[model samples]
Target: MASTSSGGTVELSGFFADLVRCETRLYNALNDRLRERHGIVTSQFEALRYLRDHPGSRVADLAAEFAIGIGATSKTIDRLEKQGWAARQPNPADRRSSLLALTDNGTQLVGAAEKTFTAEVAELIGGTLDSSSATAAAQALSKLRSVLERNQIGTPTG
Candidate 1:
C-alpha cells in the first residue's frame, strides 16, 4: 500500500480503489447467494426488507434511500409486484404517488432470506477481520458516509 503526499495531506487513491472493489465483490457474492437460495437478487431482497420495515413508503422514498433513479426503482418494484412479493396502494395523502408494502409472500421470503444474509455476512466479513478491526472500519466508513450525505456529495441532480 503506497500513499502519495500532497503538501501535508496523504492522498487516499488506494483506499478509494479498495473500497469500490470490495463493495463490488461483496455485492456480487451476496447477490449470487441470495439468488441461489431465495430466487431473488440482492436488490430485491433489500427492497423487500425495506418495505417490511417501513410499510407504506413510496417508490420515490426507496429510490432516494438506495440512491438510484426513480425509473430503476419503479422497475424493481414492478418485478416484485409481478412476483406477488409486493404491492402498491393508493396514497390518500398524495393522489399522484402510491405507497409500497410487502405482501405476505414477500414477508415470509424476506424473513427466511434475512437469516441467510446474516450468516453470509458473518462468514465473509467476520471471518476476514478481527472484532476490533471490523468495528474501527465500520465506524470510519459510517463517519465518511455521514459527511458525504450531509453535504449531498455525489447525489444526482436533475
Candidate 2:
C-alpha cells in the first residue's frame, strides 16, 4: 500500500481531522461514564437535559437544537419517557407537534448525572482549563459553528 506522510493516515483536511478526533475522544470518554453511572447514552442525557432546562420545548425544537433527525430525536425522547424522566404534552401552539418537559424524576436524575459528568470532565482536563479558558473555548466553538452554518459548510446533526 502506498503511503504519503502523516503515518499513512487517510487524507483529511486539518479542520475535519481535528473535529473527528475531538468528537471521538470526547464521546468515548463521556459514553463510558454515562453508561456506567446512569445506563444512558450521551445523546439520551442531552435530550433530557434540554427538556429539563426548556420546560415546554417542542420536540421539533429540541431536534433542531441537537441537529438530529426527527425520528432519531423522537426515539431518544421515547426512551426518556419510558424511563419516567420526561413527559410530552400537546404543543397547544401546534396540534401536530408535542411539547417536551422533564418529569420530576427526570429532573432529579439528570441533575445528579450532570454533577457526575461535570466532575469527570473537571478531572480529565484538570487545571488545564480554568473558567476563563473554558468560556473562551465555548465562545470560539460557537463562533466556528455560526460560520459553518452561515456558509452551509456543516449543519449540526444533533
Candidate 3:
C-alpha cells in the first residue's frame, strides 16, 4: 500500500538501523574481551595507546579527540595514573595545562592491547562476512563514517 518512494525510505532506514545494531554488538564484544584479558576497558586502552602514540598530548587534546567531556577525560587520566600506566608532566608551552606521557607499563599494555584488539576485530570481520563481502562492507561503512564526521553528525565541534 506504500508508494515506491516510501518503500525505499523504509528500506534505507532499516539498513541504517541494522548497521547500528551490528556496530553495537561488535563494540560490546570487543570491550568485554579487552576487559577480561587486560583489566581495562576499550576506552581506557585506547587512551593508553593514544598517549603512547602521541606523547605529551594534553588532557584537553584527548578530550577533543575522544569527544568526551573534560571531566571524563580527567577521570580517565586519573585511572591510568593510578594503574602506573601514565603520568602527567609539566607543559612548557602552556602553563595552564599538563602533558600526558606513558610509563613503561603503559607502553607494554598498549602493545598487548593492540595485538588483542587487532585479532578480535579481524576475527569479527572474518567471521561475519566472506572476504569480498567484508571488503565491500568495510568500504561502505568507512565512507559513511567519513561523511558523518565531516558533517559533524553526533559529534562535537571544537
Instruction: Return the lDDT, model 2, position 59.
Output: 73
| lDDT for each residue of candidate 2 in 1-158, tens digit (9 for 90 to 100) | 33365546544477567767877887788889999998887888888888877889877777777766778878888888899999889887788988888889898889988987898788766556788878977896899788876775644544
Ranking by lDDT: 1, 3, 2
Model 2, stretches more than 4 Å misplaced? 1-12, 126-136, 150-153, 156-158
Candidate 1, residue 3: lDDT? 56
The global Cα lDDT (0 to 1) of model 3 is: 0.87
Off by over 4 Å in 1: 1-11
lDDT scores in order:
0.92, 0.80, 0.87
Q: 11-77, model 3: which lDDT tens digit per residue?
A: 5676778988997998888899999898888899889988988988999889877777788899999
lDDT by residue (9-35, candidate 1, tens digit) is 544886788999999999999999999
Which candidate achieves the best lDDT against the true structure? 1
Highest-TM-score candidate: 1
Q: Better model by TM-score, 2 or 3? A: 3
Error of model 2, residue 8, in angstroms: 25
List the candidates' TM-scores in order.
0.92, 0.80, 0.82
Model 3 residue runs over 4 Å out of place are: 1-10
